[model samples]
Target: MTWRWLLLLISLTACQGPDQGDPYRPYLRVADKDDVPTLDPARGYDTASWQFEDLIFETLVDYNDEGQIIGELAQQWKAEANGTRFVFRLRDDAMFSHGRQVTAEDVRFAITRVLAPETGSPGRDFFLSVRGARTCDKPGCEVAGLVTLDNKTLVVEVEQPDPLFLHKMALPFASAVPPEIIVREGENFDFRPVGTGPFLLAERVAGQRLVLKPNPYYRGAVQPRLPGIVRFVGVPEDLAWMRYRAGLLDLAIIPPAEIPIVLRDPKLSRLLRTADTLRTQYVGLNCARPPFTDVRVRQAMNYAIDRRKLIAILHHRASPPQGIVPPTMPGYPQRPEPYPFDPPRALKLLQAAGLGGGFQATLWLRNDETAIRVAQSLQQDWERVGVRVRLKPVAWGPFLDAVRHNPNIDMFLLGWEADFPDPSNFLEVLFHSRQIGANNHTYYSNPVVDALLEQAASTTEPAQRTELYLLAEQRILDDAPWVLLYHPRTMLLSSDRLRGLRLHAWRPPRLAQLWFAEEKTEE
Candidate 1:
């Protein structure tokens, strides 16, 4: 037999008891963006923050690999009164990292914190269905929709019937936090989080790195497979890939420029993995501004750009625009192509809008390498039809503020990934007038579209709700507030030694299921 087989045989022979064997593998390594903005679940709106929060926190419900809703903290939930009310039963053995049994009161306090104005949670809008949710700004404000019956049972009531509320519960924003700990630690509790997850935050080095270890009191059915995980940050994307090549990181993200080189290499190509992401990139116009206020000008801009060319140059894995709503989404409408690459037609439309001489405008974008390529491509495409464009690249936070507050910015390039798998999450949240100065950066508003979205949310029947959503999507497409670009596929590079690395479409990868192939399997 081979030496590897001999070692395995000896290990098996040396096993003296059922509780003893080779010790569990100790470490896992991965790469992330420059920094994690925040570890606080309530204020985590960015991807990096959500990634860390997802690993260290547990929500009431979660999505499985096939995108179906599954129970996490709660053992099971029952819907009654035509989906108006939901009753959840906590698992008897659930325990927080501090070794306290998780109770229903903890759930109530966690949600009340999100509702409090002091928390400043961007996800507060998601829970408006609860009675008195709109007016309550402080804890103990008598929310009629929330009630904890005993130590293990809780009830939630909504004003209208909503079948999608369960899906919303699976978001990271709904993850439970230790109420007593927060009360004692105050705002500092955000950085020092405590949750009932498989892993706990063991150490952090400001902007440099973060380390997590298996939770001793974890109550989940599956414990963390590795003893510990180390996440490195602030490393440039190219340099991170180099680290991956040298076996420093088990996982790394492949940048757009290096995709070709990686694919050409025989050894590197075997380790490539790809998944379709539920994300959409677009160039949003300021609908309230002077030139873009005209629908003809908006249509002209969309028609001038060559979308397929952009995809070929920067992203071979991206699919061309079907609509602002990704095609994979339920209830997506089949609509006619309102704008294709027609420079002459674009010129005519601009002339009709009384801009025959063309107009000067600025496009705002982030200062990332990929964003720069996208901005340059758009400039070239628009200049072909007489529109002069200037590119302004800014940092991420300042760019978000400028898009929301600066009225002079003619257009901006950005992208939105779905928080939940629903049509309302995309169509209504982004185009609804109520969201202006928020995610609706375009200031897009149409009374007809508004009514359709509201009706869809209130409707109980799935077929009827789908029709209403389709109508709203069509109306927004006709308005052309955003020149929808493409849906990107997620590409990840990892060491071949790593196994069971599955992707979650709406969130980050789950770390509990991953293990090194060389390690002996857990019982």
Candidate 2:
């Protein structure tokens, strides 16, 4: 390790230890970089919000460790009408934290709430396949497709046979919320949410911290063994590492700069955990704007960067991306490199696109240290190919707002994590023209790609669906709306006192499964 990093680690080790007053406290303390924006499932979209939502809310279905969809609130479900209609049987013992019995009506209300235009849920597009969802815009409009036959039984019908409907049902957007609570709390419901999950939100101190306690009414297969979970929010990665070494945090995300140092330390290396995630980090080129409007320019941008060097900058914590679809997802084509590191080819393409003299464009990105470093690398790489790049660093929330709302944004660095273990989550949700203003920030449009995505969505046969997705993905790659960067692997350091903490490929960590070593004997 470098002398500078070694001295930094030594200084961190010299700090005082964690508070001794809580030595016997059973709550697992964690350090998070940002505060959760919302706890309501319908409004929560970011990773920080999803982590808390996953703990406090219960979806109808969930993914098993094997990546298969399994029942959660719904004990059993059957597809009928050629996979167009689904009937779900809820568990009779499921009860919300507010002492209300979870019922079919609650499930129906939760889904319809997302479809309601008043809700303004970004996830509304995910549920557009449900019948009557498109037309149900007004508040309090009953969706004709969602039927509550009994307290424990519900039925959902779609406009067409959707092979991944069950997968969509497993998302946090489809989490069940009590209708009574919504009626009573109204807009305040986002903060005072009550659900049938393993944990209940005990306290939230805005930008400081959040405390969660076990839900007594939770009847899930695996019970929460930890007494509670405490998250120290708004803690920067550098401070988080120092706090982790001082024993204040049970878990901390290893920042890019500190990763090598941690790996070199024998004791810290033993606490380090790494796992490949279904996420893709890329630079989005605005296809609707100047320069990038030409397909050749977009392809040139992709060819300019050396992915291997980018991975090296990340300390080899990421793999070179083959395409938009991550390798972990099914139907990912193992094709030849689409755009290798060839600055000459990139300059030639730019010249053909009438930009031989080079053009200036601003690249917007998150202000985080890691993002800034990557952006700097990209700026250096593009400069070699006669592309003058200006970097604009903004905070995470404002950065997303500028990308989504500002038409002047030329290019931006972002990452997309798979919401479901399907290629459509990457291909269709990103490249489909219908998703332009939503997840498709590039505003790319291709009729052939859209048709293939539609066909794949309705195709019930897995093999045929995979083929259609592959075709759409290839078309998207040819379009080159994004300069594909790398697929990052999640790296975290956990305290030795914590056990049963595993990183999932796509979903949030299963907090219910985590327990302290001291508590394991009691269990």
Candidate 3:
């Protein structure tokens, strides 16, 4: 019995040592933001949760740094029956961290679990195109679209032709799960996530920290060269910056207030890296309510704010956006000069809409210093046009709830990042009438815009789709459902020794290929 225990311990520690491929770097250290509301992949729609989930889960498809879709778990796939049906071939070599082979059955079960209404996954809308996906109201609710032909082959059939369906599968929500573990653990499974990715969740200290170790059975294009990773959660932004500067942390975001200080110092500035993100921040106006329901009033609000100045103050790392779609995405149209900072025009529009005296409304914001600054700037700008603004700052969870369902919410500060790089993600999900209370928080609806978006989704021709999408965008711009702000740039500070780091707009930095050189003393 003692000899058997010795063998079991040896088997467990076999893959725990430093990788032979890269002998120097043994661990990767990062800051885990406190903003991560949940570690549950299905319920976590924020950037923080997605970043950690990407390390622990393997999606069927994934995107490269250039936004090209590539295979992750599924070795290859074929689009059959005019893009409505897709057949995926899973690699027999792929295995979970628990020493179980990943199969087509696992893929089928994972997707259906997300679509199950009982899970209340915020990402359920992404899978509605799958046949019978809407019927997943309970546990074990069958998804007719998901079919496992064998251990390696799986098929999915959608109701209509969707060219972007493959891209959607690359999202972290499409990660494969082991059915046996899920059935055994039930609702508590996400706390101890099991997947076939480059890393496995070794420890999670509730909301404080999460630790990961490399999985030897991972069969992806990239593998974790580091032996372990530690993500420090609930650390204050300023503390994170201090730790990075003191060499206690390897990577962290440069706090907005500290950017100038870092830029002034040559040594610190050398560590800074920045890239424009695919997210667009905006102030949503309730189109269902009065005062904002009038197109003239909405347009007046759009013209009143000085976006360029606000970008300079609140987000020096951001670029002024002419439209909702960020510049990072393809097919973004060239735009005319933005509405132009003309207060007289805004005043005239307000008078034309019988709101010459303006109206009083509350502006909702999350409990963030940056958001509060932006809100104050807008309040002062709108005052010139006779609109009195009352500011209300709430915690993260309550803020989302109020913004999504509260009828009294006149306006709110929020942002959206594309789950996949396509115009339909913004046009159809954010502004389309069908998503009124769901993704369309503004309650915006236009028959013409809806028709154009629907046509664009179904159209296979690239040129035709672009034309239809652009037309819908123009219509939305004309209606002014939101005061489109700027697209922020994601900035990071890392030790100069960190190599092979690739930042992505939709996902977190790909850390599997990341390695570190020997530390050097600063000049």
Candidate 4:
């Protein structure tokens, strides 16, 4: 057993160690976030997976690390007179890893796949808002929201006036696909991904490692400093740090709990730093089933949990949130009084809902050390309201699968980092009634809230967009769809030798921008 353990450690070290391919170029050291669930962009929704996709694949337009609109495949675009027709012109030189120039047809295919019911894409909700997008799901998207006008220009029509559609197009789901690969292989194409980004998928070994080499046809001014990125997964958090310290891993992700330890170390203090962001965390109440089915019960449960305790337990690494949209969000209005952490108030609501002594229920959460701790604290807090909470802690993979299999839990902890700096990403995706099934774990539905979110998404004017979101946020909070928790402050630790590891303007660390310092020889 000891030898086996030793071999496993050695393998991880080798997997994360700096590549010997290019001694002149320094590869950024990053912790392998987690096992990537899938590569089919439409299929899974994991942050770590998105981190890779953020580099490997891109949309017609892009949001830089600062969340600013930048061009990727689509060099430039224009909207037709009616404001319904959008024409995006692809770069003439853009080519996939297979050496094929990306075309309007590929964009048409990718968008349709996301909207197709057959694929069960998590992003379907966001795209379905486009005119005729739902039509693609049932039969074909031929006459749906999109059109392949030519090889270079693709157009889309929305049901309503949506000026912000272009902004949303800058996000990932709307990204153009390599039609040849996805069509020829189907599921097999997932393992062998081909994209037109700064990086190309080099190698992937299941439950082990993934490597990305720079795209030869990359169309960027500042070329990626690293020749290739090799990602190793399932490295335990503590072991990940140890591996980094041993110079086996280049980038180490320091969890909120370990931030202090990394900062205190003299060798590590220079490497350790904070990457702040408005990363919201919450427990989604299973509003589709009984107990939580009653809005008052949901509200009661919300009041039962102490938001302050949650942030404190997490080492003040998060800000309390009254709803999905935090105050930092552009259009969010400050709610003076949050859901008070009063057990008596909770009892009253439960009693009013005809459950005076509270009820027995199960709350689900990812089986990580930190997630389990949060769930345990929630259980303890709700118990004070006479709510007997059963804790269901499963590993991240199984937990997400179980929740999607059946949205029947009384509650489950969920984390959402902004996909784009937009309110619709927060409201419509989670609370929209049509967005249920595998992706919509909350099972939230309210006609009024839905309308507001739709209105917000379509409105192009910044002020008007904010107003709609303000209403939407208030509505969701008053109804207590989920026990809104806290917005997390991302804490990152790096080696003193690493530079530019700071959180990008778009909110998360830009893996592509990280650089290593030059080594010194002994005197």
lDDT agreement with native, every candidate: 0.80, 0.86, 0.81, 0.73
| Model 2, position 359: C-alpha lDDT score | 93
Worst 10 residues of 1 by lDDT: 16-25
What does candidate 1's lDDT look like per residue over 73-161, in tens digits? 99999999888899999888888888899988877777777777777777777887887788777744567888999989989898888
**Residue pairs with backbone overlap in model 3:** none
Q: Write the per-residue lDDT of candidate 2 for residues 151-260, one digit (tens) a residue.
A: 99999999998877998999999999988788898888877889999999998887788899999999998899899999887776677777777677888888788888
TM-score of 3: 0.88
User: Candidate 1, which segments miss by more than 4 Å at Cα?
Assistant: 1-26, 331-338, 397-409, 519-523
> Which segments of model 3 are wrong by more than 4 Å?
1-27, 405-407, 520-523
lDDT of 4: 0.73
Give each model's clash number. 0, 0, 0, 10
Which 10-residue span in candidate 3 carries the lowest summed lDDT? 16-25
- Displacement of the residue 208 alpha carbon in candidate 1, Å: 1.6
Report the Cα lDDT for residue 118, model 4. Answer: 88
> For residues 67-109, could you state the per-residue lDDT of candidate 3 as single tens digits?
8888888889999998899999987789998989998888887
Strongest candidate by TM-score: 2
What are the models' TM-scores? Answer: 0.88, 0.93, 0.88, 0.89
RMSD of each: 7.7, 3.0, 8.8, 3.8
Model 4 C-alpha RMSD vs. true structure (Å) is 3.8
